[model samples]
Target: MNVPGDGGKYAWRTEIRTRRLAVPREEREREAEALAEGVAALNAHKWVCAYMPVGAEPGSIAMLDALRAVGARVLLPITAAAGPLLWAEYTDRDSLQRARFGLLEPTGATLPAAAIGWAELVLVPAMAVDRRGVRLGRGAGYYDRTLTAAREDARLVAVVRDEELVERLPEEPHDQRMGWAMTPFGGLRRLGGTEAEESSSAG
Candidate 1:
């Protein structure tokens, strides 16, 4: 079932996954704390769609709490079959349960994919993201499908470590571009698009 253009993506995923696994646990914890702080500083949003990081992913559960503290009613992805993701409200760490793909998901009532329309901001998980807004995910295509339901004005932001923010990455037609990247130390950076242009001029 391999697609013609997927070989390059496969290689990138392997390399990134290996690199993530090499990061020390202590460093990961520190990055998680910094990420939470970064998310906390963003302008408050009424609704946000975010994910719970697992394994060597660049964030922690605290990021959810930070979003909540910033006045967002946070929604976390709940994996279904092979289409767009379902969502559920994130109440607390205690509400999370083990799910498919080794992900942690909230136990609240599941909402349909269209629930993404409620979010004013969508925080996506990426193995890497380029300045061009090309996000390299784990190749699941889940976010790709899910984000199609996001509100037109919703800000799509990728959460990654500083090193994972690069200048370029392979892109596919079906891949959705992120408008911003949130790094642990670097905070929020505008990616390719109108926002990037505005940020450049303001600087």
Candidate 2:
């Protein structure tokens, strides 16, 4: 169910993001361990789109490995001249390179957007998120643009530390909330579950 909003939601979301930037290093590591374990069990898909990690976000490296270890096809982002985002098949680590942003992307042969729907899962990156599947990104709108073409039933999951999933996040018409928040300590949190929980868990 989509969580209804009133006032103070945006404020809460902002606070959650701030908290993560300030979370103790030890706590962050524990969260990472939980996330890696959970991802290892989701071995029921053929294709996946996941992050390659940059900074404090729950790094997608673990998820990428699980996907590949299960022989699932994986895809990563590619910077194209035509747009702010693009998709390419994951070939090999040697073919990947660091982009202008700290993100690592595929540099092998580019894949058409038409080939995007082939994936059954999309593990996204976000600064913070709410349950409505509308993610609060780094203000880039990169996933917002490309995810529009993802398969309707394909899971759009944002892996974050428990502190990154907020009770109520700022939402605009163009933003997309993820289906679930995969946090480190808390397991799977269905977005917008309850304010008290979202706040305290992420807080």
Local error of candidate 2 at residue 85 (angstroms): 2.3
Model 2, CA-based lDDT: 0.69
lDDT of 1 at 137: 91
- Per-residue CA lDDT of candidate 2, range 44-156, in tens? 68888777777667754656666777777888877565544667777667767888667788787777765568888778888767666557776666777787788999777
Give the clashing pairs for model 1: none
The best candidate by lDDT is 1
How much is 97 displaced in model 1, in angstroms?
1.1
RMSD of each: 4.2, 5.6
Give me the runs in candidate 1 sitting further than 4 Å from their true place.
Answer: 1-7, 193-203
- In model 1, which range of ten residues has the least summed lDDT? 194-203
What is the lDDT, from 0 to 100, of the residue 63 in candidate 2?
62
